[model samples]
Target chain A: MNYGLRRVLPFFALILICGCAAKTMVVLVPDPDGKTGRISVSNQAGSVAIESPNQATTVSSGKPPTPPVAMEKETIAALFSEALSIQPKRPVHFILYFEKDTALTPDSLKQIADIIAAIRERASTDISVVGHTDSVGSREYNMNLSRNRAASVRDILVKQGVDANSITTTSHGKENPLVPTEDNVSEPRNRRVEVVVR
Target chain B: MKAITILVTVTILILGGSVACLAALDYVGIVKTIAGEVVIVRNAQTIKAEANTKLLKGDLVRTGPNGKVGLIFEDDTVVSMGSNSKIMIEQFLFQPAEKKLSFIARIFQGTASFLSGQLAKLAPNLVYIETPQATIGMRGTHLLVKVD
Candidate 1:
């Protein structure tokens, strides 16, 4: 019996050691919209190496040896098939349209309560407020108008107890339209502010 | 007789200690939502999933005919699995300060949606989702994967 136990003990030990040596692998996929994605991997024993398109990296042990590195991708998919775990949290988005040449519409004003409620429900601190405009205005004019709209929404969110630093505001102007229109066209949905709560 | 009992007790204690240590270091994430019936299998043990149920690396998640499950990673990535689905978290590593980011998952069957987070935003090339038929490398912020 003792001899049998000794043989089994060594087998269990071998199993444990092999399991501990499993390496973590990361697979990169480019974004479909022609945007680039980037990633860098380094370890204590090796210098940092960044992955190019359709590349993979392996990290031994669990601890990372250095700080984050950036890479470029066209369509990005980061797959860490080892050494990590995940849970799911659905993100919420709100689109508030503006009146002609104005920052906020009455309909959008009423939606503020809903936006605030959604933000509070998720208890998320990171939020994005992006503004847009119809093609009715000049490029320069639309840019400034979009910025003003986003800033206004950011201010309201701050007043509703969201952290000022957590909200990032940007303007797409007439570049990315929800409803693509000809020049100088008036599309209500095109002139809007989009709020994404992450 | 007394010596034999003591030997057996010591062996049991050692085995239990090893298991406890493994559990302590194996935490990955928690179940954020569940509908219908969902089960998680890890370390050869299966359990019904509920909100806040902890998940570990190399876990197998399955849903019943009308089930759904959602999970959020430490890196803020979200994964939602639909009914009659089976998925495995093959790997995940997110340490921003150290610049370590990777996410890989395999879908055996059913539908799943992935939303990129800080890791994918920072290092897009490190994320991948695999299916029996094909492997998807995500460069976009969100992807919906379905497997028959």
Candidate 2:
């Protein structure tokens, strides 16, 4: 649509559009997961929120951003081709379950090979292993237990030729659970280590 | 007793501030992709940017006429810009353990893309993008911004 306008107009028309473009413009696109999310654009005048994909809003003349309107795909590509071109691959996440205390379940033990393959495929230099536990034991005890669970995974990967420094292990304890359970409830899903390969 | 309590509080505050200063010395992000003449300005010094180069919190990335750069922050936030663009890495604090999460940047000019990362997923309202005429609060979405 914008290309049509430019094709019809001549030289001086370029300068007429705020000396080449609007003072500020924002275009919301679908997230990596293919889900459209909301975007809010605000200025000295007011705020306008848009939820549709490819919606664009521009704050011209400071009277708040005009109502967000759907933008053509070509317009987005023309404006952001370079930026979109250089985007790095999104990170991938892997979950490994544990049996009791610092020991990985049999299936999870086998999953380490898959995690390593992902690391090699992505040439990932940054990896984070976060451990979580079921809502059992004291918070302080669960925190320590979670750290040990994370260390168990980190140590195995380090022994398997992964860089120790590239991996950061943190203990989330029972604070974050896959399945929300009552205090002291034993949930196997909660005892897990999440590895994010980036 | 009151004076002693005040003295202890002041000492703790000073220690906390120094700890934060020490953390700032760590790299907040790394350049994932670089093409042409992308450069980063840190502490008034301009340095050529390359792939895998670490970006500090206060670094300002500026691109030449044909330059483009992509960066992934510690919390997994991604920022990419086209030629003739300037994006300031003003603030990035992602201490999830302590619940201290913030990501802020200012785009001085040109075209750029921003994708909210783990921090925004954790707390969307804390992420922000500042432009010359407007301030945008990012909410776990992707944005294409142009400042002319």
Candidate 3:
């Protein structure tokens, strides 16, 4: 070949080799009737998992567990690897505020209890209580009222078997109205505590 | 004469390059034809998906009424969407060595089973599913997500 042609040929050859080598996983299956059955496993889109058919072998004594087919092992490996990546390091927390309830009713209490139990079952995290109320009465009166509401919730949670230390209580009375409508009217929704777990 | 020869060679190269690029983007895992509705599955019953549209690879898919669609990703990862449920692929990549994948399926209303592959291990957070109330993150191995 001419000198110019020779230079281009190697570059083309290199590109082809790189392209072929980039594909690593190749799925291959065994022939149903082969002398020594061997299957190649790959992560390619069409790989199928094959299980060995059982044969009637009399077993009165202990027998060693048969090893899985190579393809099965490879497939399992791929799954495990993928699972490891998506696993969450820690459970996420959500905050829920009671909007339209002045006093904790039995149904509301039950719902709160259920939510706490659900959170506990799904994740292990601390729950915080931030209580608030709208502008009404005196500042001191509102603060005590908010604190009482928070404590009442905390006590109910404790009765439900949640550790007292796992809970933190704080009150924001007549200070932070979620809607901030500038009237001295008591908005039932604003007089509530938020449950947050993080 | 040399310029003419070079011109002809350049034209051929340009045409060949365009053809190769288009070919690469053409083959997708699953193509939704006729604009089918995605179902939200719950307790094996399929409901309409929140989003109504045709499905492509990585398209959020759920079972339709009384039907379950099983998906096996390019890397042999198996994810089953429950009836009356919701899910999104979020991200998926399947190359051998440099394989990296991220799938986020928001389960707004039901259950799902996730089985991971090698690429998923490389980037765990790449695959995230957001629901109406929570975001489920995958840990190593197998998991069944039930959003009730």
Candidate 4:
């Protein structure tokens, strides 16, 4: 009876070990926009870095992750299909330059229609229109000007039937410039309103 | 002296309450898609999730069997989970202007697809995806994780 019990104990131990094998898995894939990135998986034992697309690693108990191996597309799709299927569409960002102060440039003004279309398409839960200014004025002056710039964009969205509560406006006040310039320099590119719909 | 101490403590309490209220008003993420039974346990309150449900830091998301859900954080980070999944939004501090940024998420069980956002590009090392066994350090990338 003792010998039989020992054999059964070994069998249960084997099951435990196998159950712990690859119990946790991680795979690096390209970002939604197809941009490549890398991930380092680490445990108390050691770490392995994977940059290749579809590379995967299995974390085991009390051991460093196994070396990363490239996983098949089908395998990845099958395992992650549910999560993938529910993936949200990427946020859309738009930059509309200001002609002067708070006025939208002619080309940018014409883009209002397209911007509205994007907001509608996403059924955007929230929208942020941040205003920026070239360093052409006093900091306080630019701050107020930037606020107005952002408010103008928000007004347009609200006028177009977007919920006002869903839109937020911010002013960067020449603090974050697209084209870095010395104070009081009018950089056209730096004077812009950025809108992100998500 | 004791009265002054009590006054100071009361003032701190009031200030803390206001800060919490302000923080609650600022949502860090939104639920973009939900199918089946997905609920968010936030501050110990179970709120049924719907499309566009605002999510706050420290919220725990659990997906029932046959459930699936997706979220997009303020910085465009995306996370989608499958059925029988539990995820915690442990911490999120993004202030691009001040350069204060961190995003950490812990998954207790099930599968998830993660897509990094602005933080991934701005400061990848500050983002982390932690599981019961291992931790994933990212550098502007996407990841799929499963725990069974």
Strongest candidate by lDDT: 4
The list of candidate 3 runs beyond 4 A from truth reads A1-102, B1-148
lDDT of 4 at B130: 86
Query: For candidate 4 chain A, which ten residues in a row score worst on lDDT?
Result: A9-18
For candidate 3, write residues B40-133 as lDDT tens digits: 3334455454311223344556555453444444443445554555676555565332344555555555555555543456665555545443
Looking at candidate 3 chain A, the ten consecutive residues that score lowest on lDDT are: A53-62
| Order of candidate numbers by DockQ, starting with the best | 4, 2, 1, 3
Q: Note the clash tally of each candidate.
A: 52, 0, 22, 0
Score candidate 1 by DockQ: 0.05
lDDT of 4: 0.87
Which residue ranges in model 4 land beyond 4 Å of their true spot? A1-22, B1-24
Write down the C-alpha DockQ for each prediction: 0.05, 0.47, 0.01, 0.54
The prediction achieving the highest DockQ against the true structure is 4
Better of 3 and 4 by DockQ: 4
Clash pairs, candidate 2, are none
lDDT of 1 by residue, B48-109 (tens): 99876767779999989878888766556778777787889898886553466788888787
- TM, chain A, every candidate: 0.57, 0.87, 0.49, 0.85
Share of the reference A-B contacts seen in candidate 4: 0.79
What lDDT tens digits, residue by residue, belong to model 2 across residues A48-133? Answer: 88788888777764668778876767668877999999988777788999999988999999999999998898777778899999
Native contacts retained, all candidates in order: 0.10, 0.69, 0.00, 0.79
Tens digits of lDDT, candidate 3, A42-104: 121222222232110110112221223233333323322322232222222333344433477
Could you give the CAPRI-style class of model 4? Answer: medium
Clashing pairs in 4: none
Q: What is the lDDT of residue A78 in candidate 4?
A: 72
Give interface RMSD (Å), model 3: 20.2
